[model samples]
Target: MPAFDPCYTLIVLAGGQGSRMGGCDKGMLTLGQQTFAELLVHRLRCSAAAFNPGYGPVLISANRNQQDYGRIGAQVCADLRPDFQGPLAGLEAALSRASPDLPAVIVPCDMPLLPDNLPAGLLRSVMADQRSVAVLHDGHRRQHLCLALWPQSALFSIRQRLDENQRSVAGWLAGQLVADVTFSEESVGALPFACNINRTSDLAQLPG
Candidate 1:
């Protein structure tokens, strides 16, 4: 394994309009005792630690509730435009604030149960394959938002996509050379950690 890179940045995507949750900020929604953003911070810290002693700062991409998200103990950044363009826009904003030479792990705030080995797993694939992007695959489908990492060099591609009004993340990934890092059921547990809470009904299904 390559020496752990401490410059890897973590970008927690919380900038969506939350149209499905009755227009509420999903990141602020309570998952048991903690808010989604809070849960992600706690989990991500553990994941990063397992990979390296010192990683780069966590950046929360949020459009509303900036101050509240900041209270979660992470640097907060808003999208370049305020119309809630989607996660890609938030990703672009976060990338701009991060160091251009290093890689960044992008995740949705709603998927707080991300595997503890996420950072290390993504980095390993990225280095081994020498690809600009890598994401977790849950044996069946690509967990694009739960865990995805890319070198800042791909920021230009993201910008070009946004300029063309192409907001589909899958479409963007399809255009790039991507590595799929598959996590077995035993490794991530019986319940996939990539699962996300998208609607109020989904809350009732959250693992306790």
Candidate 2:
């Protein structure tokens, strides 16, 4: 993906309580020696500087452990919804805080192996159609909610869907013009970008 306009924000969702991981904060959990959240923030910052230089900003939607991640230097925000609605709610809250004219690229903190080229690919896909939401696909299934580029203009509809008690990311995305950009499994190798570390057993699946 070639460079284009540089007005995009990368929103990292790190607010989950990690119930499956024995209630530990997945973002702060150690993948090896370093915390997963710290690794993600480092990689994202590097990617942004390399691929999307001059990008608007990078924001993180954090909850109780906001200070834990504040050291990363990205803007951190508390969940806007009363309960932990889900990743969509986090995105909605982050979107609400973003500039209306700027686009946003979002990813989850649990995805430790997110593709380095993901931001550029999402931007390319979304730019193909102004009204379309760009997402990542692992060939077989769309990694629909994992990595996405969303326009701030969609905030109203997103909030409306949330108000209606709709929490499905794929479902909400379906209502919009959406496009899937495939990432070759070979390119990512054994590191699965979509492999979320939710439980202790899930950690075993990570490359040692």
Candidate 3:
């Protein structure tokens, strides 16, 4: 793979308890027509194809309803460890489920209006910076928790962090060789991406 190539296995992270949403399946929540995870998968697949049109599989890191997520036309896996330990657990599952050599792009299932250039921009930083992970820096904030790309080389450090009870994704990231790819309205097509629907009422926060 070339250093700047835009090819990667995509991981749609939906393995949360959705405690704020009253234990609902956030990924299965319908926004307009399709569910959140479904919409994200569709948009990402379309955008990636338009960007490079290459071969890369999509993986879903879902804790429950494995069958439901499987229907999305992608491989699905649960957290390697127990509980919804956050995106890091989901990410570990994603890494294990994907081809060993290919790096994977991780995106939360709730961000329906994600940037089209997310994978490319992050992957570019991954290669250029030679870092274990490269994540989105949304101009004013580093969106480090859920959106990013990681290579298999990161598995050891990740496993170590999780084993030591270091569950915070941002906290674990601070200890690794990471890159922050900046994004602005002019660059990413949206400012700060989209607000995650933490509650059912949050649907109103979506664009009209």
**The candidate that achieves the highest lDDT relative to the unseen native structure:** 1
Name the regions of candidate 2 deviating beyond 4 angstroms: 1-5, 46-55, 187-191
What is the per-residue lDDT of model 2 for residues 1-208, given as tens digits with 9 covering 90 to 100? 6555455677888887788877777778776777777777666553445555455577788886888788766778888898889878888888877766666778888888876677777777766666778878877788755555555657877899999999888899889877888888742344466777777877776764
Deviation of model 2 at 16, angstroms: 1.7
lDDT of 1 at 82: 65
Off by over 4 Å in 3: 1-5, 46-54, 186-192
Writing each residue's lDDT as its tens digit, candidate 3 over 59-173 gives: 8989898899999878898998876788888887788777766667788887877766677777766655545688777676776654545556777777888899888888888
Residue 176 CA error for candidate 2 (Å)? 1.0
Clashes of 2: 0
Error of 1 at 106 (Å): 0.8
What is the TM-score (0 to 1) of candidate 3? Answer: 0.86
**Model 3 error, position 33 (Å):** 0.9
* Model 3: worst 10 consecutive residues (lDDT sum): 185-194
The deviation in Å at residue 141 for candidate 3 is 1.0
How close to the true structure is residue 38 of candidate 1, measured as C-alpha lDDT? 86
Q: Give the TM-score of candidate 1.
A: 0.87
State the lDDT of candidate 1 residue by residue for 147-170, as single tens digits: 445645568898999999999888
